[model samples]
Target: MKLLLIPDKFDGSLTSESFANAFVAGMKKSGVPFTSRYIKATDGGEGFLKVVGKYKPCISIEVISENPLRKPIRSYYLYNKEDNSAYIELAHASGLELLQYDELNPMLTTTYGTGIKINDAVEKGVKHIYIGLGTSATNDGGIGIANALGYIFLNDKGEVLPPIGSSLRLIKSIDDSHVSEKVKQVKFYTVHNVINPLFGKDGAAYVYAKYKGANDKVISDLNKGLIRLNKVVSDKYNVHYNDVPGAGAAGGAAFGLKSFLNAEFLGTIDFILKLSGLREILHKESFDYIITGEGKIDKQYLNSSLLQSVIGLGMEYGIPVIAICELLEISKEDLKEIGVFDVFDLKDEQKNLEYNMKDTAHLITAKTAEYFSDK
Candidate 1:
């Protein structure tokens, strides 16, 4: 039998690399003799670069930048030379993980680090840039990034606006004169993990800002800033991205890229699955069963994420797919609706949240191996 040990990170518990190893170890201990394949599947989240490492060596670049809450931090971007492409995972620099619960303020955070990374990629002469827009800690509507790329935001008094939400309304003119020549030649792709527009009740600020520590007033400010910034971008560039699907991603970075750089926006899972050649792998191997999962499985699993892609590919071969998650939130009917034959949770029956994660992983691996070997 052949199995694919493909799983996203367990969030707070394990990284993708660690989960892959533990899963394979469990299969071996269960005495399931099978060829196993490992693939990193990041749906524009923090573990994105770790998964991409399976395919390429990442080029590291350093730049002085600020985190989501405007605190200084050093960040890195991964460059894929073979494809002449660069990947910017915002979480790697200015993500929610960079701040504490109390520090999560959308009103003050910015995408400045994200912009600096893009500038570094351009300087490296990359022709294509793919930005993974998930786990952001800001609501600046991509103004911080555009500023780094030479799109100056100014007030009526002709003074440059500070890189924050409160100052977004001060914009009167945009200057693109200093934007590097390479920027015009490169193609930009925004990989959005969610489908939210830039400005509306369901827009970035209203829906997601709360998680970033926004109160009612802050959310109002964020929305206003996004509205103003979108207009500025559209009026100057002759494009409107405010109502575009996925425009609200990464705290309006999605809208910013679409309007300013003419980037192609795609579902993060779909793009990663295609790039990883997942379908080809499934076609090459005909297995009786496929086991797939993430650190946790919830209603969101119905979306086109790593586990969903695995199930879809398995169905093509008439194979049953069993999802093994660190935690499972769906009912049996819901699991069926999502295309999983069965769902397994790795948590101990008697333990609470503080259960030893390593032991739990081994237990899950053993159970998975036994399930296949029994067949």
Candidate 2:
């Protein structure tokens, strides 16, 4: 059988690259006489550039920037000189991964580093820029980025306010007189992994701030701040992005960019697949099965364009699609109705979280061996 293996990062246990390697190693050890092709999948998260850079020609540009906590760090972006286009991952500068557990306070973190990266790219004369927004450590509503790009936030007393989540409530006016000239010439595109809006019950603060270490009071404050910022943005720009789909992505980075930078948003999987030419590959090659998975199989995965696209491709080609995850939260019948042929979970009766985390590669290999052995 010919199988296509395309999996996202398994969260804390394995990256996409490591998971593919382990799965392939297990197949080899099992002596399974099958052909396989591997491709890494990313929904604009940590491994975005690694996967996109695999298929696109890009020049790496490194710059000194700040982390979520405003600490100086070296970050990079990929630029294609031929098209004068650049790709920037928000996580590179202000990702939650850049901070320690104790430092992960959303109200204190900022996206200033990401803004600095954007400023660097714009100054390089790139005509078009694509930003990947995911796995961030801030909920500043993009004010931090605006601050980096010379958009000043002022209090009612006309004093500058720090570009942090807590300062959103104190902003009296946004000053754009010092905004970068380079920003006007470029077209910006934002790729989003989720479809949540910028404000309300399903908004940025309510939906994501807790994960960034927000307490009940902080969550309430952040939500109010988001509401205030949304109104201010609409009053100034005459455009309301608060209710737009995907506006809540990356802690309102999408909403901020859309409101201030004229950014267009695209679905993460659709854009990446097009960039990687996955459709062309599927049309040209014949495979019996497609295997894809992430760290967990939950309701959220059901809404992911990545999984949906994989299932669509499998159905179109009359091939079966299987998912192998560390944990399975959905019922088999539900998964089957969505076009997944089967799910192989690492956490069966004989395994637990600790065992799976400790020996992920071995477990995956053993499971692959058993599955094909039965077949």
Candidate 3:
């Protein structure tokens, strides 16, 4: 029997590569006779570059910046010299993980560090910049990023506002005269997840503000700021950004990029899938079972569309696909309807998830080996 195991990272527990390694070790120890292959799939979130790292030559560029709490943080960017292309993952700077529980205030956090990365890349003379926008701690609509690029947001008093989302409402004028000339020549692609608009109930504040420790009043203030910022940018660009797809990504950072930087948005998963040659791999291999897993399996997994794509590919080849997840909260019928042959939970027979990962992995591999060995 042949097996393919492709999984995303288990969030904070294990990287995709590490998870693959663990699964392989368990398989070998259990005397599995089947051939197995593992792939680290990226939905254009954190490992987007590494999945396609071979296609793009990466050069490290040091970027001096600050995290969400204004703390010093030294970051690096990936530059592809061939196309003069550079990519920066937002998690590297000013990400949600960079902040402490007490430091997750949407009104105070800023994407200034992310801006620094972009500026550093632009100064290197890159023509195309791809910014992966996810896991941000700030709710600002990219004002802080523009501030780093020399755009000033001023208040009615004619004083520049501090870099924050809640302050975007007070901007009486936006000054772009101080921006570098090179910025105009550059094009930007914002890699994102959601396709929601920039404002209203479905917008950044109401959708993601609570995750960053925003309260009811803070959410209201943030939505107001986003509305005003959206108007200012729409007027400047003469393009409506209120209902644009992906504008709500990264706490409305996509909206800010659209209005301020003239950037286009692409779903991270679809982008990464094409770049990683996943289609070619799927066509080239024939497996008895295709095993895929994530940290959790819920309604969102069915909605991701990337998973659906993978499942569709598996079905086209008549390969059985099973899911092995940390948590399985969906109904069995739903799993079948989505083309999942079976769903297994790693947390179900164990009390401590972290402590039991190794043993659980061993058990899963052994079970797989026994199943194939009998066949």
Q: Alpha carbon lDDT of residue 326, candidate 2?
A: 86
User: Residue 201 in candidate 3 has what lDDT?
Assistant: 85
TM-score top scorer: 2
Task: Please identify model 2 stretches exceeding 4 Å from their true place.
Answer: 25-33, 300-305, 312-319
Tens-digit per-residue lDDT, 299-321, candidate 2: 75554336766777688889899
TM-score of 2: 0.91
Model 3 accuracy (lDDT, Cα): 0.76
Ranked candidates (lDDT, high to low) = 2, 3, 1
lDDT tens digits by residue: candidate 1, 6-101: 566776777666766777877777676777777667778686666666667677656676676666787777787788888888887768989989
Give residue 216's lDDT in candidate 1 (0 to 100): 94
TM-score of 3: 0.85
**Cα RMSD, model 3:** 3.2
Better of 1 and 2 by lDDT: 2
Q: List the residue pairs that clash in candidate 3.
A: none
| Model 3 lowest lDDT segment of ten | 300-309
lDDT of 3 by residue, 26-115 (tens): 566656566877765665456656765755677877878889767889888888888888988877786888888998999999988899
Task: Give the worst 10-residue stretch by lDDT in candidate 2.
Answer: 300-309
